[model samples]
Target: MKVAVIGCGLIGKRRSQTAMEHPLSELAIVVDINPAAAEAVAAQYGCESATDWKAAIAHPDIDIVAVATHNGLLAEIAIAALQAGKHVLIEKPMGRNLAEALKMAEAAKAANRILKIGFNHRYHPALAKAYDLFQAGAIGEIINIRARYGHGGRPGYENEWRGNPELAGGGELTDQGVHIADLIHWFAGLPTEAFAYLQTAIWPIQPLEDNGFGLFRFGDGAIASFHTSWTQWKNLFSFEIYGQKGSLTIEGLGKSYGIERLTIAYRKPEGGVPDLEDLVFDLPDTSWELEWQDFIEAIAAKTPYWGAPEEGVSAMRMLDALYRSAKAGAPIHV
Candidate 1:
C-alpha cells in the first residue's frame, strides 16, 4: 500500500512515520497547506511533497490516504480519497459530528474501500491486556464503567482551531470525549440512554465547552460515566470496569499522564478482601504503530479491525446524544 498523508501536523507526521515503517506500505507523498511543513515531513521520510491534498489523493499510486487535518476537513478529504479508490484512515471522532461521519461511512461503502478510524488508545499495552482479560471472562458480567480523561490547556489554546465551534463541531466532548465514548462502547457496547452537561469553564470559548461530563445507561441497569476536561490542572487518564467476578482498572497513558498501569482485582465470595494484581507499562507509546499494522493486515488479509465504520458511527452517535442531552437538559435515548 502506498500512502499519502494530508496535513503535516503532529499526528500526520506520526501516521507518516508508521506508514513508512510498515513493510507493506510506502510513504509516497506528504501533503499540507503549508509547503514547508509538507516538505519537512517528506524530506524526513524520503517521500514526495505536495501542497494540494486533492491532487495527491487522486494520484493512482497512492493506495492509502491518512486524514489528520482538523475536525472540519476530515470528512471532506476522507470521502474524496475513498471515492478515488484509496483506503482511508481518519483521526478519531470520525468527523465533526454524526452527520459527517455517516456521509464518510456511506462514501466508503459506495466506493468499496476500507475506512478505519484512528483509535490508537485501544492498542495501548495496558488497555490491550485488560481487554484480553475481559474477553477471556476474567471480569465476568460487566455491571458499570467509570472513566476520566483530561488535561489542562496551554496558553493560547482558546485561539486554536479546536476552540472554534464551527471548526471543532463541539469542544471537549468531540475532542477527548469521543475517545471515551469509543472506549466505553468497546467495553460495553452502545448505551441505551445518555445525559450530559457541558461547560466552558475557563477557555472563554463560548458555545464550545472546555469541560464535558456525561452519563450513560446500558441495558440491565448497567451504567457508565465519564468526564473530559481542559480544566484539569493535572493530566490524567483513568478507566474502571466492575463486573460480577472482579474489576479491571487502567490508570495513566505514559509520559505526562504518568506510567500506564492496569490493576486487576478478583472479588472474594466471603467478601473480605479481593486478590489484586498490578501490571505497569513503563515504555514509549507503540499504539500508533500497532494500529497501523492492524489496518494494513486487515486490508491485505480481510481480517477484522478495530475502529470499524459502524463503531465510529456508534461512538459519534453517543456523542451526538450527549450534546443533545446537554442542550435539552435531559437524558436522550441513543
Candidate 2:
C-alpha cells in the first residue's frame, strides 16, 4: 500500500523507517511544515516530499496516511484522511479531550475506513505474554496492578511537541499517562472510576505537569496504581500484577526499542521445579516492526484494529477525571 506519513519529526521518521521495511508498504510521500525536513526524509526514503499535508492527502497513490503530527491535531487530520478514502494510523493521545476523539470516531464510522490509534504497549512481547498468562489462568484473578513509566528527561525531548500542551496535550499524564490508563483498561477491563494527582515538579518551561499519579478502580476488589513521570534520573518502565494463583511481572517494556523480559511466578501445585521461575521471552526481533506489520495486515483484512477510537475516548475520560482530582484534591468518578 502507498502511504503518506505526515510529520517529519522523530516519531514520523521512525514510523516511516519501519514502514519502509514492509514489503507491502511504499513510502508515497512525507509532509512537514518545514520544507527542508520534508525534503530530507523524502530523499532518504526515495519518496515525494511536500510542506503541506493536503497535497500528499490528495495524491491518488497515497492509500494510507499515518499521522504523527501534533497530538491536538490528530482528530482533525484523521477525519480528513477517513473522508478522503484513506486508512489512518495515528500516534497516541488520539485527542486532547474526549469530545474531539468522539467526533473523529464518528467521522471514521461515516467514512467506513480503518482508523487505528497507535498504542504500541500492547505489542511488547513481555506485556503480550503477561496478558496471555492472565487470560490462560496462569494467574487466577487479577486483584491489583502496579505500573510505572518514566524516563530521565530523555534527550531530544527537552524541547519538542511532548513538552507543549498545545501540541502534545496535557502534561506527562496526558502524554504518558494516557498510555498506562489505556493499558490498565486493556488488561484489567474497563475502569469504574479514577482519581489522580499531577504535579509540575520538573521541566520548568512546560505548563503541563511532568509527573502524574492515579488510582483506578476497576470492578470490585480490583484497583490499579499507576504513575507517569519525566523526572526520573534513570529511565524505568515496569509492571507487576497480583492474582490469586500467580504473580506476573513484565519489566523493561518501555522506551522506543523496549527490551521485553517477562517473569512469571506461580505457586507450586505441590512439588514443582523450584519454587518459582522467570521465563524469558524469545519471540519477535523488534516490537515496532511487529506493530506496523499488524496495522498493515488489519488494513488488508478490513477487520477491527487494536486501538479503537472508543478506547481513545475512554482513556481521555479517565484522564479527565484524574486532572479533576488533581485540581479538586478529591477523587472524581468517571
Q: Which one is best on lDDT?
A: 1
Give the least accurate 10-residue stretch of model 2, judged by summed lDDT.
251-260
Residue-pair clash count for candidate 1: 0
Please give the distance, in angstroms, between residue 41's alpha carbon in candidate 1 and its true position after superposition.
0.5
Every model's Cα RMSD, please? 0.7, 2.5
**lDDT tens per residue, model 1, 46-80:** 99999999999999988999999889999999999
Minimum summed lDDT over a 10-residue window in model 1 is located at 153-162
lDDT of 1 at 325: 99
lDDT of each: 0.94, 0.82
Q: Candidate 2: where are CA atoms >4 Å away?
A: 154-159, 254-259, 268-274, 281-285
Shift of residue 84 alpha carbon in model 2, Å: 1.1
- For candidate 2, give the lDDT of residue 136: 90
Q: Please list the residue runs of candidate 1 whose C-alpha ends up more than 4 Å from where it truly belongs after superposition.
A: none
Clashes in model 1: which pairs?
none
Write model 2 residue lDDT over 121-168, tens digit each, in one string: 888878877888888998788889998988757555648777777777
